[model samples]
Target chain A: MPGDDGLRSRFPISFRFLDRSRTVAPPGWSRWLVPPAALSVHLAIGQAYAWSVFKPPLESALGLSGTASALPFQLGIVMLGLSAAFGGTLVERNGPRWAMFVSMTCFSSGFLLSALGVATRQYWLVVLGYGFVGGIGLGIGYISPVSTLIKWFPDRPGMATGIAIMGFGGGALIASPWSAAMLESFGAGAGGIATTFLVHGVIYALFMSMGVLLVRVPPDGWLPRGWTPARAAVRPLVTTADVSARNAIRTPQFWCLWVVLCCNVTAGIGILEKAAPMIRDFFAGTATPVAAGAAAGFVALLSLANMTGRIVWSSTSDLIGRKNVYRLYLGAGALLYLAIALAGDASKPLFIVAALGILSFYGGGFATVPAYLKDLFGTYQVGAIHGRLLTAWSTAGVLGPLIVNAVADAQEAAGRSGPALYTTSLYIMIALLVGGFTANELIRPVHPRFHEPAAGAPAAGRPLTTEGRQS
Target chain B: MTTEDPAATGPHPTGETTGETTGRTAGGGRAVLMAVGWTWVGVPFAYGVWELVRKVAQLFAG
Candidate 1:
């Protein structure tokens, strides 16, 4: 309720014109423009993945340990999960324009403020700036375009969401080398890092504003040319019935999907977190072993797989259906993990292919979940629901690395080395994937009781609610 | 059952949903939005893809 006009009133007068609630797309506007708007924000915040580029420099300049230097990025992730959960409803209420603007300001300002922190050598300032303020921007920016995209492309929610989420993964790929080059050019000192932060802030703010100007919500009941709601609803998992974000969370389907995402992500992160070292260990005894540079290359390849999988797999979900697609992700993913576990560097090519497939599913898991949410919960509060669901990711982020790293450490201590170090972790991941597959299999159509009753149909179990909020 | 309701027959059960802007594109505005949209989405996306390709190339080149 506080989000409606209250959120809009918080912004300065000059910015009100950009708010989606007040603005209108000109006559003859194409729905095609919406993805760019969503991408603009995603590409900007996706820089979170590239924070490692700054880590070595920060540790060197500040004389901080690796763990200490990583605080900003870690806290940024924690805050991303927290703020998205808290601010999700507000974003839904205030509209995408408002959310995008807030994200742009907070995200850019986080960089600017972190620059100030670096110039002064105040580590806490960097932590607060990038982690707390910028993290909110990441969370809001992530969800801002999702529901709108789902609305515009009701026929292809998975595909629509995939394009935008792929930007987040790609953002890191672009920013990693770009940020590295900037630091190199400017000199990898405190001054150089500060300058990079400033440039990033200014550039991202400018880039994200494009989305602010270009994005508009589709008019009510608008469908793509030659599309009908009935056709899209034909799938077994899809429902024409809408559920509010608030109530959607109460449903068993939401938690089942939540567990599904958590396990899938946790399983994938096991490999992603240790790609470089794991590859080196697996092939150390080979005639032409994996070198450091090649190990780094292997890591880069995984990133490519991550980005490609988001677009390819999620888009595929649109055709084959979300449930069936996830069946492939978790089902195939488990088998791949099993393959790696059993093969145990017996064949290097087998390890590479299996790992790539796993990473692809990792990225696909992210791009596809929003559509899954839209299927179970209507677009009314899909953004908010998605926000809540991201806690699964946050949970997995910690769980994944912990399980993998912890197991690897234990193996080394026990005098085990090479492929055996990862053997147990791989089996664990397989089990987790199997768990996710079962959860996915358990998903059924949301019962009629949860559906917002149609007006002409007469109010059934639930009241005639629109946009998930009861009028 | 509400599932059989005429209102449920469409995308939104209530028929009139809030924040729905029926964007009608005519000849000129539609063309401009299309060009602008593609360029806007395409540039950054292409750049990202290009960077990724180059990185992978470097990985193999080594």
Candidate 2:
């Protein structure tokens, strides 16, 4: 009878009791459940990485130039950052369910509209459907599950996020093959691309809904078993106060991180956007003729590295601490770019390793950033801050490709050959990474003025009122 | 499942129920809606795969 009571008490159907016991709850709602919810949104929105797949088709079908065809994808990324920044507070307020639902609706509709545009032979329709409308979905869906996972596994925030963020990277892995098959089956003209878009809208809408339905916030005050507030508070990395999303924008830390994210992303994407061309240039003089097939494999391998680094490197941050982890990312990333600039076609292995390393940092930057926010600001409103920080990504989305393409275009016009096209771009990325490294070093603890007073506890730190002015 | 267990006293877990598992009783509509919800999640992911493959092939072809 006594044992029964204990068993009943421990395993009470109502999660309310589990909160009180505060001991480790038997892996609350299968950890398995968390990944699917994250994957649903990430995998669906990940279509961004595969945007190049449509680039060729759109250019030919619309008789548009490369830059013109790229406009939609570029605009969609811009929208992603803007929407995520503006909608972040809304996402936090409404909960993941509402956020994901909206994402599904917008993203899917974007596709459906693109289909119509394709059927009608109107390029603007494709842009409106895929770029503007769907971009809203990409932004919203991207951050929808972040706060929830942090809430669920306060113990392992980095790994929890890595699982979902990795899905974003992997989405391309799945989509590249599948989209090709559909394009082949349907034909790669405007009609074929449009059909693919329609199918993507319908399908992603369906997939993302699972996350909306399954996600549940932990009851307030629920901490993992064996975890205590005192211990959680004591970590040198943890900040206890909540920063209003508005005020977060005013802080130097926010801008510094913005620069950090933008620079890191711009550096990586500059290479990624021009992966095949960069490789071709590197191997141009070799007898082997870097086959187009091998170049494609190189891209896929880069994706794998990107996805794997998100999980592996970010999870490692949990051990090394967020700031230190970023030091590695930026500091080493600059060196990698330098290696590429110096190596320039002479050594294939060095080139591959350097490129892969840079791409890994690119992905690591995304995955590690949320945890960094959690460390600097408390979990109080990290999702919103994160959403705000993503504006940098939108900026980088434009800047990264622009720098690479414009530079390459100019170099090609000058009849440059054999890695000269990218040398300047690589040096620019190195400067950007160095700047980011400096910003990382400048990040000290959140100023005392920013600390939120604990309930019924006297505030311990100096007020932050004057700190923002100093910056 | 009486509510006397001291452990149950913390802030109410969002979806906790103190009573017996109300065996297959309520919210059939909600359940169906959830099932439909999951379907929405799968379609995009499937499409993403299709798109990824097509692009990789083109990269190779060119």
Give Cα distance to truth, residue A72, candidate 2, Å.
2.5
The collision pairs in model 1 are: A28-B24, A28-B25, A28-B26, A29-B25, A218-B21, A219-B20, A219-B21, A219-B22
Off by over 4 Å in 2: A1-28, A60-63, A189-191, A232-235, A287-289, A413-415, A461-471, B1-10, B13-62
lDDT per residue for candidate 1 within A144-183, as digits (tens), equals: 8998889878888888899999989978876888889899
Q: lDDT score, residue A81, model 2?
A: 88
Could you give candidate 2's per-residue lDDT for residues A273-330 as a string of tens digits?
8997789888889765677777876786677678778989889888878888889889
Best-performing candidate as measured by lDDT: 1
DockQ of 1: 0.21
At residue A114, what lDDT does model 1 achieve? 95
Q: Which stretches of candidate 1 lie over 4 Å from their true place?
A: A1-12, A455-457, A463-471, B1-26, B58-62
Native interface contacts retained, candidate 2: 0.24
State which docking tier applies to candidate 2: incorrect
Measured over all alpha carbons after superposition, the RMSD of each candidate to the real structure, in angstroms, is 5.1, 8.2
Computed on C-alphas against the true complex, the DockQ of each candidate is 0.21, 0.17
Candidate 1 chain A, run of 10 with poorest lDDT: A1-10
The number of the candidate with the highest DockQ is: 1
